[model samples]
Target: MTLYPATLLLHLVGVIGLFIALSLEVAVVSRLRVAKTTTQVHEWLTLSRVIDVLLPVSAVVILISGLVLTFSAWGWGHAWIELSLGLLVLLGLLGPVINGPRMKAIRVAAQAAPEGSISPALRQAIFHPVLRVYVPIPGLVALGAVIMMVLKLDWL
Candidate 1:
């Protein structure tokens, strides 16, 4: 049950897309803290929109294609593969269900807050307490995915 090279290539593309999206999210947030101008704020908002829409889609494609490759390459019931895919799904779901609404609230607040008085309240909401937990989740999951893929732990 070998995978064709083309399918593997597509899966890799999805993975890379997801990675890029996450990187952009980090960059956008970094700029957000010092976003002095309205235009800068708008740019960050637009980036957030792109991330909100595209990141999940790319993640879905990555997970589905990874599953296809896993089944085709190693068959179902492989322990580490199942665990890895489940974790991927969890990571994907967390973005929309937990992070999306929070980010939207932050964005709306940012837009409403007048220039030069982007208050601490607005910044606090945008970089909420939950972010202390949420921001690191993807990185850890991605790291685990890499490790599991490389090790192929078969603990059943």
Candidate 2:
């Protein structure tokens, strides 16, 4: 019933949720790639609803629980904890405010268009920029967060 145990449980559950969401994305993207018609792609688009909901919720839980753990362990002044907490905040905000809406647009477009009507040029135009940037930012932030948590250094 302690804060530590509760936070740990929430963090673990958040990670599990994130893992499931990521797996769903991979499966859905693969299905989208192989889809020959709009109906097939639209069918796959339904998965986006799950991702759109779960991803941010899991991220928020992970971040809030992580911040609870950090604050409990290392007061607010601790550089590593602060850095990890900051990255978590960034992920939560950016995922929802920026990427989430863009993804929703893409999904809506996919669902609304007729089979084979989504032009290759339009597809690339719609997705390439987001695909290029959104994925890499998370990896870098995750790496920074892990290093901050593990090292617990005074890099401030």
Candidate 3:
């Protein structure tokens, strides 16, 4: 197969993986919100860390494949491609700077405390304003990028 088809396939698969990861995050967050036991919190924290690893991997695949696509045929000068690239970069920056450290702190707290009851610190971290604000941005931005790519919507 050609590089274009291969890269497009990779990009599409990456988007699928990222969407699944995002959905998992949402479901886990929902569980965390209603978690009443330490074990529940701990489980969610562990899952959060595990999924964090996978999430970034999918994102990187999407980005690298998109880059490959751009250089091959999409071209950097096209406004739609540029917008999609911009949103992907935004999401790439958003996750590490925002969600990563916050999740780490929660995981640490969960690990330190006994597996009997959920700690206030852990709960607060899960509900932290900064986390709450940034957690959904990447997914939303990814969705926007997908929309722009699919619809070829270029304002410029």
TM agreement with the true structure for every prediction: 0.85, 0.74, 0.90
lDDT of 2 at 121: 40
Which segments of model 3 are wrong by more than 4 Å? none
Residue lDDT tens for model 1, 95-126: 77777777777777877777865667567766
TM-score leader: 3
lDDT of 3 at 9: 96
Candidates 1 and 3, the one with greater lDDT:
3
Cα deviation of 4, candidate 3, in Å: 1.6
Top-lDDT candidate index: 3
**Please, what are the lDDT tens digits per residue for candidate 2 over residues 33-89?**
566666776777787779878877888898788878876865677777777777777
Q: Assess each prediction's global lDDT (C-alpha) against the native.
A: 0.75, 0.69, 0.79
lDDT agreement of model 3 with the native? 0.79
Clashes per candidate, residues 3 or more apart or on different chains: 0, 1, 0
Task: Report how far residue 87 has shifted in candidate 3, in Å.
Answer: 1.5
Per-residue lDDT for 56 in model 1?
80
TM-score of predicted structure 2: 0.74
Q: Per-residue lDDT for 1-156 in model 3, tens only? A: 989898899989989989888877877777877888879887776677657777888889988998898887867777778887777777777777877788787777777877777778877877777876666666787787787788887665
